[model samples]
Target chain A: MAVTRPGGPVDGSSPDAVSIAVPERASTGPVVARALRLLEAFSDERPTLTLSEISRRSGVPLSTAHRLVAALETWGAVERDPAGRYQVGLRLWEVGALAPRGPGLRERALPYLEDLCAVTRENVQLAVREDDEIVYVERLAGTQAVGVHIRVGGRWAMTATGVGLVLLAHAPPDVVERVLEGPFTRHTPWTLTDPARIRETLAAVRTRGYAVSERQITSDATSVAAPVRDATGEVVAALSVVAHHGNPPVSVLAPLVRTSAGGVSHALAAGRRPRRPR
Target chain B: MAVTRPGGPVDGSSPDAVSIAVPERASTGPVVARALRLLEAFSDERPTLTLSEISRRSGVPLSTAHRLVAALETWGAVERDPAGRYQVGLRLWEVGALAPRGPGLRERALPYLEDLCAVTRENVQLAVREDDEIVYVERLAGTQAVGVHIRVGGRWAMTATGVGLVLLAHAPPDVVERVLEGPFTRHTPWTLTDPARIRETLAAVRTRGYAVSERQITSDATSVAAPVRDATGEVVAALSVVAHHGNPPVSVLAPLVRTSAGGVSHALAAGRRPRRPR
Candidate 1:
C-alpha cells in the first residue's frame, strides 16, 4: 500500500531520481545520488521507516541501503525511532536551516510576521515562488485565528493563495505563463480557476502592489497579501494575513501587510536584523 | 585562513568524515559520507561558498568535487547563487523540515512558547539533548524581551543555560558522567564550574521540577526552565523563559514555566496539536 506520503514530494518523484543507473563498478556520483534520493523518500506521513521499507521506497538494494544508512547514521543524517525505524536526524535539520531561501528568510521576516499576526490576530503566512508553485516559508496562526492552517514548506498553486498571487504577478514570464495555463485544483467555489480571471487578477496585483484573495480556501477566510523584495528589488517572497471575511474588510488589512512586507524587504536589503530597544 | 566555520560542527570534526578513503574506485558509502561532510563544512559563518572553497573545506579534490556537486545540485542538495557560488538549497531545507526532533517538536511546542513569550515578554527557548550537548529546537523573542539571542539549531554545553541544565539533569547516566568529567569552559564569573555544585544543582532541579540559571549567560539575564515529558514520562525536551534577573523573581516565573512545560508535555502525549478557539 502507498504510505508515508504527505502532500507528496516538492522536488518531484523520488523513484525517478533513484533511477539513475549505477555501473557494475563503484561510482560515487550515482551512489551519492541514490543516498540523497533515500532522503527524498521521507515525507510528513512517512517520517519513520523500517530498513525494508526504506529499501523499497528508495529503490536502493537492501545491502546498499544498510550500508548507506549506517554511514548516514554515523553523521547524524538519520536517527532510529523507538520502533527502530529510520527517521530524519537533528543534524540534517541544522544544516538545512542554513538555506538562504528558507530559514534564513524566515529569520529576517519573523519579527514582522509576528507583528502582523498580533495586529490582526489572524493567520499570517510568508511564502516564496518556486517554479509554478508557492512554498510557504513561515506560518503563524494567532490564538483566535480563522480556519487557515499552512505548513512550512507546503506547496500550493500560485492561484490558490493571496501571497501566491502576489508572487505570481512578479514571477518570470515563463513562470507566469505556466501558472496561467489552467488545470487548477479548486478548494472552494470561490477559488480562482478560470485562466482569464486569474490573468486579470495578476495584472491588478502588479498595478496595486498587493493582492486580495477572498474565500479561496474557506468560506469564512479572506487573505490580503503584499510582496517582499530584496536589494535587487526582487519579489523574493510574499506576506499575507488571513482573517474572517467582512469582519475588518480587506482594505484595512492590506496596508498593514504591505508595510510589514516593506519592513522585511528593508531588513533583507540591510542584511541585519533591526534591533529593538530593550 | 580557516573561514566559513560556524561554532564548529555538532557531531564532531568533519574533516575526519571526508578522510573516509574514497577507494581508488567508486564506493557509494564513503562518497556519500564525503558529500555529507561538505554539508557540515557550511555553518552560520559561511552559508555560501565558491567551488574551490567547497573543495578546500571538504577535503575533496576539485575534479571530484565538481562531479559530486553536479549530482548534488541535480537533487537540490545544494544551489548556486547569482554569483555562481554554492549554497544550501531550499529543497534540502524542505526535506530537513521533516525531522521530528526539529520541526515536529517546534510545531507542537510553538503555541505554548508564544503564550510564554507573550505573558512574560521575555525570550522563550526549547531544547533537546543530543549526545553530550543540548540542541535548541526553537526560540521566540518577545517584543520587549531581554538580550537573549539563540539560533534555532545552535548547540551549547549541557550546563550553560536553564534549558541546558534541565536537559542535563535528566540525561542518561553515561552522558551525565561524561559531562561531569570536567574540562568545563567558563563563560562568566557566576557560571558554575565546580563539579560538586553542578551535581547538587542537578539534584535540586530533579526535586524542584525546574531549574534556575541566573546570570549564567549574561550578567543581566536569568532563565527558569522546566522539563517536557512524553507519554512515557521520559524527559524529551526542556522549555525555558529568560528575562532580566529577579524582576518578577524565579518564584513567580517557576510555576508559569512549569505549567507551560506541562501543557507542552500533554500536547506531546496526545500526539495532536491542541485546537485553538476562534
Candidate 2:
C-alpha cells in the first residue's frame, strides 16, 4: 500500500548500520529499529547466525541484541537452529503467507501459472512491482535447455527482465521517471541500459501486449511477458515465459504467455477463494 | 531453535494486554514487544486494520502505535492497503520464505507431494510439529466430493488429523505427555480423545508405519499419513492424503502416502538444492 510510509528498512539493504546505531546520534536507539536491524541481518546468503553474529551484524549491543532477540523469539519471529543459532521462524512464515501482494497474489495466480508452465515447457515467472524494483512472486522452471537461476523472492531492476518491463509499463509516472533516471545495471552486451531505448521498449510492450527480452539476464534465454490485471482493471502483476533463445519464436510464445496472464487476471476478477488463511 | 528462549508473545493469543501494558507493571514498556504487538494485531479475519484499530488491538498507546507502525512499515513487515489500512508486507513474506521448517522443507518435499496429489486425485498435505500441535506447510486440494476445509499454515491439535497423529506419535516424551494430559478437543464423534486409546493408536502408527484418521476432522473425509524423516532419520514432518471417506480405503492410500513420504525423506537426506533461495 504505501512504500509511502517509512524509508529506512525495506530498501532491500542490510540496515545493520541503522541511523540510530551511532552512539553520538542517540544514547538509546529506538528499540523497534534495533529489532528490525536484527531481522535485516538475516539474509538468504546467511540463513542461520549465532547470537554474537546477530549482535555484530545488527550493530545492536550484545546485551541489547540478547533482550531484543528474547522478545522476537517469544513472538516466533526469530527461531534458533539446531546449533543454537538464529533463523527465521515458521510462525513468522505463517503470518507472512497472509501478505496480499506476496503469497495472497501468488496463490490465486498459481493454477494459471502452472498451466502455462505445463504448456510451454519453459521457465514461467510471475512478478509484481514494488517501488522501482520488480520482485518475483513465483517461478516454475521448465524442462528446457535454458534453465533460469532466479528464485521466487528474488528482486531485479526493471531494465533487464521481461516481467519487469510489463510491470514498469503500467507503473506510476513518477516510478517510471525514477526507473528511467537510473544507473542501469548491464548484465550482458545485449542488455538494455540506455534510458531512451527502454522508453521505446515500453511503448512496444504496450502496443504488442507483451515484452521480449532476448539474451538479457542470460545469454541462453529469451523472455516474453504480459500484464496481469485485477478486478479494477489495474495491472497488479506480470507473467512471463522465459524460453531457450529463439527455439520457440516470440511470436509462438507471446500468445501463450498473454493467454496465461489473462487467465490469472480472470481468476483475480472472479473473486475466488484465494487459498484463504485459516 | 529454542521456544526455550522466551514465552510471552506466541501462544497464538492476541496479547493485546502484554504484561508491560499495565502502567504499574513498568514505567516504560519494551518497545520491541510493543512493535510485535502491532504485528499480532493483524489477523486473517482482519488482514487490514486502521491505525486506531491497531492501537486498540495492540493495547499500545495511540502515539506509540503510530511510532511503532512507522518502524514496521519501514522494515516492510507491514504495509498500507489502498484504503490506507495496514496489512502484512511482501518484504516480510520474502524473509519468512527463508524459514527452514516451513517453505524450505516444503519446497524439497513438494515434487513428491504433487505426485501423490496427481495420482490419487485426493487432497494432499504436508505438515511439521510445533510444540504439541501440527502446522500445515502446504496443502494441494483435490477434486472430490469430500473436500477438506483446512488451509496451509493452519494449526490443529495432535489429536485431530492424520498428519497430526503421525507427528505426535513420533514426538518427544514430554510433548507426548503434555498432549495426553489434556482436555482434548473433539472435532467429530469419531475423533479419539481418550488418553489410553490415543496411546494404543500411537503404537499402531509406529507398527504400521502410517496414521489413519477416519471422519475425525470431517465426516466425509478420511485421512492417511506417513512420517517424513531427515538425514538423521528423525521424523521431521508428516505427509498425508485426505480422501473421500471409505472410497480409496486406508489400505489403498497408506502405501502411496508412505512411498511419497519416503521420497521426500530421500530428497531431504540428499541435501538437495531445495528451491535454493537466490
* Winning candidate number (lDDT): 1
Over A41-85, each residue of candidate 1 has an lDDT whose tens digit, in order, gives 788878889888889998876766776788788888899866688
Candidate 2 TM-score for chain A = 0.85
Clashes by residue pair, model 1: A4-A46, A26-B26
Q: In order, what lDDT does every prediction score?
A: 0.81, 0.80
lDDT (tens digit, per residue) of candidate 1 on B112-148: 9989988988889999988999888998876777887
| CAPRI rating of model 2 | acceptable
Colliding pairs, model 2: A80-B1
Residues A98-182, model 2: lDDT tens digits: 8888988888898898888888888899999888999899988776637676887778898799999999988889999999999
- Give the native contact fraction of candidate 2: 0.42
Which model scores highest in TM-score? 2
Taking the candidates in order, what DockQ does each have?
Answer: 0.31, 0.29
Error of 1 at B189 (Å): 1.4
